[model samples]
Target chain A: MIQISRLPYYGRQMLNWGVTIASVIVCALILPSRLPGMELLGIGPNWLLIWVVAWSVKRSVLQGAIAGLALGLIQDGMTSLHPSHTLSLMCVGILTASLKKQRYVQEDFISVALIVFGMTVVAETVLALQFSLVGDRSLAEIWTDHQQIALSSAILSSLWAPILYYPLNLWWEKMNWIENNA
Target chain B: MDTLRRWWDRNWLQVALIGLVISTAWVARQTQGGSLFEVYQLLTRPFQSNPSKQELLTNAKVVEMEAKLQQVEKENQKLRELLGYVAKNQQQAIAAPIVGRGADHWWQQITLGRGSNDGIKEDFVVTAPGGLVGRVSSVTAHTSRVMLISDPSSRVGVMINRSRFMGVMRGKSGNKAVMQFFERVPDVRRGDVVTTSSASELFPSGLPVGRVESVNLSQSPAPEAVIALSAPTSVLEWVAVYPVEKNTDSETSQANSK
Candidate 1:
C-alpha cells in the first residue's frame, strides 16, 4: 500500500477520523426519517442499533459498549429522557461483541444480518422490561406493544444491516491491515 | 518494571480513546443531543415537503371562515360573560410542519420543525385541523418533540361535550383511546364529542380531542368509552402549536400561603 503511505501523515489520520464520524452522523440523521421502502408498519429500521452491531462485531467488548452508550444517549436526546435507551443498546453491543463469530460463524453478511436480527429483539425486550418495571405503562399494553415493535424493528434492522456493515467492515479491515504493516 | 511499562504503553491509547467516546456520549445524553437534532434538521431540509397549491387554496378559505367565526364567537362569549359565564382563554396558534416521527416505536412521539426558537415551549398545546393532537414535551432550538395523545403513558381529563360527563382518557397505543368515566350511569353515547375538562391541569379546557365511537356503561370499576380521534395522527403533516396560559390563581394562592 505505497499509495496509503504517500498521503501526508496527519491528512490520512484526519481522513480516517472524518469518515468514521461522518458515518455516525449519517446514521443519526436517518434515525427519524421514514423513507419509502425503509419503513414497515409505521416503524423504520433502527439505524443506530444496526450501526452499533456492525461496529462491535469485529471489536472488543468495551468498544462495543462505548458505541452503544454513545448512540443510546443520542437517541434519548432525540426522543424522551425517561426510560433511557442506554441499557438496551449496551446489551446489544455486549452481546454482538461476545458472539465470537470467528469460532462458530463465518465473517459473512448472512451472519451479520442474523446477529442483528436477534440483537434487535433482545434490545427491544430489555426496553420493554424497563417500561414494565417503571410502571409508566400498564403491563398489558407494554407487552402487546412490545411484540409489534420488536418484530417489525428486528426485520427492518436485519434487512438493512448488511447495507451498513459491508462497507464499514471493508474500511476497518483495511485500517487494521495498514496498522499492522506500519 | 520493564514488562509493566510495555503493557502501559501498549494499551494507554486504546483506553484513552474508549474513555473519550463514552464520556462524550454521556455528555450528549445530558444535553439531550441538541447538536444531533440541529444536524438532522440541516440534512433533512431538502427532503421536507413544501406547502402545496391545494394547501394554499384551502388555507385562504379557512382563514376567511375563521375570521367570521371568531367575530361571532367573540360576541357570543361577551354575551355569556355578561350572564356570568366563565370563559376559557383562547390559545395563540403557531402553525408548524411535522418533520419526523418517533425515533423508536417504544415511544409515540413526533418531531416538529418549529421549536423554542419559534416560541414553542414544553406543555404548549398541539392540535391539528380535526382535533387535539398532543402537547409539546421537549424542545431543541429548531425542533421540538411532541408526545401524542395516543401514547399509553399519557393521561388526560376529558368530558363528553354533549352530556357533560367527566372522564379520564388513556392512550391505547394507536389512533383510538379509551376514556373511563367517573360516574356509573354517565350520560355518554356514540358520536359524542370529547373535550378536555376545566379540571385538567395538563391541558386547557374545551379543546376538542376526539369523538366517542362506542360506550360500555357496565364495565367493572367504571364505565368506558372508546374514542376514534378525528385527527389522522398516523399520517400527520402539519399541526398548530398553542401557548398555554399559566394558572395565575394557583400562583397567587401559593404566594399567599408562603
Candidate 2:
C-alpha cells in the first residue's frame, strides 16, 4: 500500500489538477453567456484571458503559452476562426508568465487585477495588429474601434478577473500547501 | 542515459496532462464546439421560453393579422394567375428564443435555442417582431448560432420602400447601419423604410430591415445613408427562422423574364 505521507501529496496534486481544469471549463461555458451587468458596449469580460493570467501567474512561460493556446482554440470555436485568437492569447500568456510578479508585486488580488488589465490591452493590441495587416478593415476605422474595444475590455476584464482568480488561486494554493506539508 | 531517464520521470506527467488538454481543446475547435453547444442547449432548456402562454394571448391578434394577410395573398395570387406568373410558396417558420449572444464582442452573433432537431439550418433568415434580425450561420444538434445583420462583414441588398432606391446595407457595429447606394443621385430621405430587395440572393424580398435615420449623399464614391435598425437587436428575446430560397435572385429574374 502507498505510505500515508505520500497519499496526501498525491491527493493534493490530483485536487489541484481538478481545480485548474474546472476553472478552464467554467471559462469556456461562460464565453457565450451575456448575463445582465456582464456586458459593456455589447462586450463582455475576456474570460479566457483571465484564465490565462491566473494560470500563468504561478506557472512557467511554456505552460502559460500552452494554456493560452488551448483556451484560444476553444474561443475560436465559440467565435470565428480567421484572424486566429491563438496569437493574441498566447502572447498574453507568455507576457504574463514572464512578468515574474512574485518578485516585484505581492501575490494578491490587486496585483492579479493589474496584470490582467495590462495583459488585456496587450492582447487587444495584438489583435488590432493582425486586423491592420489583413487590410480588410481600413486602418483608421480599425484603430478607432480598437481604442474603444481595448479600453472597455481591459477595464471590465481587470475588474472581473479577481472574481474568478481569487477562488481559483485559493484552491490551487491550498492544494500546494497540502502537498508541501504531506 | 541516467540523466535522460531522470528528466523523463520528472516531466512525463506534466507533458501528458498538457497533451491531453491541448488535444481536447483542438478537437473542440475542429468540431466547432458542437458538443459544448449541445451541453449549453441542455443546461438552458429549462429557461427556454414556452410559447404556450404567449401564444394563447397573442393568438387573437395573430389571427386578425393572418386573416388580413390571407386576403392580400389571395389578391396577389389572383393577379399572378392572370399574368401567368408562377407564385412562390412561403416556407414554414420556427420560433426560437435567444439563449445567448456572441462568444466574443468582435463578431456580432447570437445563439438560438432551436437547431437541427427543430429543423433550423444554416442560411435560414431570422426575424423578430419588429424586423429582419439575422441569418443562421451554423447549427448544432439542439442549438444554432446566428450572424446578426449588425455584423460589420454582413452585407445585404436593401431598398427604400417609398422611393424604390437600391443600396447595400452594411452593419455599423450597433443598432445603426450604413447603406451605400448604387446610384450617385439616389432618391432617399430620413425615415424611409428599408427592406430586403428582390436582387438579394441571400435574403427574400420585402422583409423589413430598418428606417433611414440620415443621409449623406455626397460622401465619396457612393452616397451613404445611416439607418436605424427596426429590431431592438440588443434586447432581442425571441426570433422566427424562415427557410430562405437558396437562389432567390435567379428565381426572381426567371419570374421577371417569364
User: Top lDDT: which candidate number?
Assistant: 2
lDDT of 2 by residue, A122-145 (tens): 998988898788876568766877
Task: State model 2's lDDT.
Answer: 0.86
Clashing pairs in 1: none
Please tell me what DockQ candidate 2 reaches: 0.71
**Lowest lDDT block of 10, candidate 2 chain A:** A1-10
What is candidate 1's lDDT per residue for B115-192, written digit by digit as tens?
Answer: 899999999989998788998988899988899998887899899999899999998877889999998899988899
- Complex DockQ per candidate: 0.74, 0.71
Q: Give the Å error, residue B158, model 2.
A: 1.4
Candidate 2 chain B, which ten residues in sequence have the lowest lDDT sum?
Answer: B51-60
Interface RMSD of 2: 1.1
For model 2, the stretches where C-alpha displacement exceeds 4 angstroms are: A1-14, B52-70, B247-249, B252-258
Model 1: which docking level applies?
A: medium
